[model samples]
Target: MEGHCLCGAVRFSAPDAKDIGVCHCGFCRRWGGGPLLATHCGTSVSFTGAERITVYASSGWAERAFCSQCGTHLYYRLLATGEYFIPAGTFESNDMVMTSQIYVDRKPDYYAFANETPMLTEQQVVEQYGFPPEDAKS
Candidate 1:
């Protein structure tokens, strides 16, 4: 499926993706207004308007990308693997499914989902997804 930024300056394509993952980490919440709804697209994803994309090194292991033209939250990427988790909203599809959530312990009490999805806390996310080496700061 294909997705684009708010101003259409940054467009991406994620092939054969249907599952949406929620992330409630502090950085994700503060990045937007709530949990990040994204799809793991891996390196298989491709982007257009590369010049308009600004990537911020949000953490040691990951970077966040957005449109320089309209500041649309684009994706969270792993520095080591070039993997991407594109924003689900960008896909503009109603068929997406919420299969899992991460950084669940950091989720605020004001909001909750009824999806009954499997959740992983910060430690579990680190263990399962893996992170950059100690010296590999992004």
Candidate 2:
């Protein structure tokens, strides 16, 4: 999948992108004003105009990045596995399906998705991903 920032200052491609996942964690919500709709791009992403990207260490095990020029939310990366969960909107268009959701317990009650995806609570995520309990910051 190919994508670019709002201002076209940073472009990227994830050759292995297949599906999208939702993250309802507080950090993700705050980062983009709502839950994150992203794709697990593994570590096969390539970039152009890298200098326009800015990264933030969101937590001990992961970081978030965006385009400096337009502040377009980019990707959330796991430091341990070098995996990248890029925002779904970053791509121009796609056929990727949303199959899973994380931090379901933390999702607010005001809105809900119609998709019947498999959802994982924050605790379940910690256990499944082997993430430190204290690393709930994400």
By lDDT, the best candidate is: 2
Error of 1 at 65 (Å): 0.6
User: Candidate 2's residue-wise lDDT over 1-138, tens digit each?
Assistant: 899889999999987566889988888898999999999888999999999989999888999999999999988999999998889888977777889999999999988999999999988998998876544445
Q: Model 1 segments beyond 4 Å from truth?
A: 132-138
Question: Which lDDT tens digits does candidate 1 get at residues 1-138?
Answer: 988999998888888789999988888888898999999898998889999999899887889989999999999998889889998999866698999998898899999999999999888877877853223221
Give lDDT per model, in order: 0.87, 0.89
Candidate 2 residue spans exceeding 4 A from truth: 134-138
TM-score of each: 0.91, 0.94
User: How well does candidate 1 match the true structure in TM-score terms?
Assistant: 0.91
Give the clashing residue pairs of candidate 1, or none: none
lDDT of 2 at 86: 88
Q: What is the lDDT of residue 63 in candidate 1?
A: 93
Candidate 1 achieves a global lDDT of 0.87
